[model samples]
Target: MTYIAEQERYDKMTYNRSGKSGLRLPAISLGLWHNFGGINVLENQRAMARRAFDLGITHFDLANNYGPPPGSAEENFGTLLKQDLAPYRDELIISTKAGYYMWPGPYGEWGSKKNLVASLNQSLTRMGLDYVDIFYHHRPDPNTPLEETMSALDLIVRQGKALYVGLSNYSAEQTREASRILKSLGTPCLIHQPSYSMLNRWIEDGLQDVLDEEGIGSIAFSPLAGGMLTDRYLNGIAPDSRAAGPSVFMKPEQVTEERLAKVRKLDELAKSRGQKMSQLALAWVLRGGRVTSALIGASKVSQIEDAVGALAALEFTGEELALIEGILQG
Candidate 1:
């Protein structure tokens, strides 16, 4: 069956500027970092994608190493694109990144011109797209010179493989340097992707300041702290949860009693405000309008609906903000 996008899709989401660029992304974007892998059912992934677009989530974030076997997520997404999203391509913002360990050899990863270029070509092939809206360097390459990496990004935009370029997992200093080089090359760096959540406030240390000063947009990954901010773990970690899975990033031990206590307190605060814990957490990230989007991952369509519901209650009062801070401090 052909998938027709909802006519009222644009009415719901709040689209914000991607830095000083002309691009605008939704307040909440869908991330294919998990569950769109080879292990997951293709039909289920299709349903999630449709529901997201139907709900006005125009951006779908992906990376070269997103799947369990690397590249499988793009393969799966390619199928979805061919089947459902081809007609609505121009209405969506599709982005992907490279720079992680994708293949065995050294050229398979990092910030080399050869790696970034070649990896994008493979990504395009797998995703069945002529070009991606945004292409990113997945992480900082300590061995590669900033000039080299930034130059490659400029080249990508000039070559028409990507419309705009972004940096992920980059520090304040690194983002500043990279933006400088890209600006010198006549291609401004548009955005930065970072791990940001109530539990992980590393962005506040310096990164956020750099973004604001440089006029670069920020999209927060793990905005729900890898599902920890939600009510899913208010009781305990379900066996099927990310913390219980074979994830190297999420661990069972991290779901300690202390964390659960904090989550419960926050959950209580959310209930008092007529919102869910997840909704409170998502809105908190976008509270100040600093972040352009909260990139969320989901396995089921219900989770997508749940995250999108956050937009309805994005406002936060001084009292609620103080209570949230108190809970975090406790």
Candidate 2:
């Protein structure tokens, strides 16, 4: 079957400029950080991608080490591009990252010019694309010189392998320095990707201020705090949940009763607003218009639909905001 995009694809979504960059990304972008791997069903991935695009999601985020085996997410997404999204290529913002352990060699990871260049080249080959809209250095490397990493990103842009370069999981000081280097090289940092949510508000400490000053946009990953902000664990961790599985990120002990109490209060507040806990969390992340986008990972098409539905009611009253703060603090 041929895939035809919805004619009204761009109508329902909000597009925000990436800092000073001319590119505008959907408020809610699909991230292939999980569940789009070789172990997952490709048909479900296709359904989610199709549904996302139909609902006006124009960005698909990926990383070289996203899959369980590493590189399989890009492979699966490449199949999706060939089968469905290839024709609408210009309408999408495809971004990928490198930095984590991808392969077993010294050149396989980190922020070195060799590793960043090689990782992105492999990513392009895996995704079957001439250039990604954004290429991110996945994390700051303490051992590698900052100039070398930023120069590698500048080089990636000059080489035409990536249209723009971004930073992920970098602190405010690191971002300021890298942005300085990239600007000197004539490729200003376009965006920053960070872990932010109502449960995890570390970015508020100082990172957001730096981004604002530097004119760099930001997209929040784990906006749901690995599903904690959602109602999934309000009662308790389900046996089939990621916490119960062998997942390395979130574990059962992390879901303390203290956390569940807060989640329950948040759930009540969400119901008062006629929204799901997840929807409220998404709205909160995109609140104040400070963050450019919220990156969401979906296991099924319905998750994507639910995430899109969050945009329907993005505004929050002062009282609502205060109550949320109280709930988070309590």
Candidate 3:
């Protein structure tokens, strides 16, 4: 049976302007960083993508090295796009990144002109698109010249390969420098994707101020702190959870007794507010004005629905903020 989108999708979520650009992204965007990989069943990936679009998640994030086998996530997403989402292409904000370890040899990774150009071309080919909505430098490469990286981004936009450009995991200082270089080249940086959650407040150090001053937007990844902010760890590690997986991104050691206690306390606070722990965590990230969107990865369609449901009631009072700060600081 052909899937049809929910009619109330647009009415449920709010959109925010991405920096000063004309793009308005849904407050909650879907990311294909995990579970949409090569080893996973393609049918599940297709269903997830369709479900996301049906729920008004217009922005989809991807990277060149998302799959465990490398490059398979994009390949899988491309197949899904062709098979299920081809008609809604214009309505979607599809983004992909380069700069991580994608291929072999000297130019496989990092922020070099050769690397960026080659990686994006391969990404475009894999995704079966003429151009991605946003192309990001996945990370800052210390070995490569910043100007060279910016030049490649400029060329990508000029040649109609990417509609906009972004940077990820860059510090405030690096973002300032890259902004200047991109501005000089006539291709302004559109957004910065950073790993930000209540547990990870590193961006609050200075990145937010830099983005505000530069008029750039920010999309926070891991808004639920890799499911740590959720109630999954309160009792014990679920066998099906990411913590139980072989991935290095989340480990069992990190969920110490102290961490579980904190999560439990936060969970109590969330229940008092009539929301789930994941919803509270997501709402907390969106409270600050600087965050344009929360990039989330889900293994199930129910998770996506739960995450988006928080958007309707996303306000936090000052007292609530103080209690959260106390819990986090404790």
Q: Residue-wise lDDT of candidate 1 within 272-322, one digit each (tens)? A: 878899998999999989999999999899998988888998888899899
| Model 2 lDDT per residue over 35-67, tens place | 999999999999999999999999999999988
TM-score computed on alpha carbons, candidate 3 = 0.98
Better of 1 and 3 by lDDT: 1
10 residues in a row with least lDDT, candidate 2 = 226-235
**Cα RMSD (Å) per model?**
0.9, 0.8, 1.1
Candidate 3 per-residue lDDT, tens place, 123-145, comes to 99999999999999999999888
For model 3, what is the alpha-carbon lDDT of residue 58?
Answer: 93
In candidate 3, residue 124 scores what lDDT? Answer: 92
C-alpha RMSD of candidate 1: 0.9
Question: Candidate 2 versus the native: TM-score?
Answer: 0.99
Screening candidate 2 with a backbone cut-off below 3 angstroms (N, C-alpha, C), the clashing residue pairs are none
Winner by lDDT between candidate 3 and candidate 2: 2
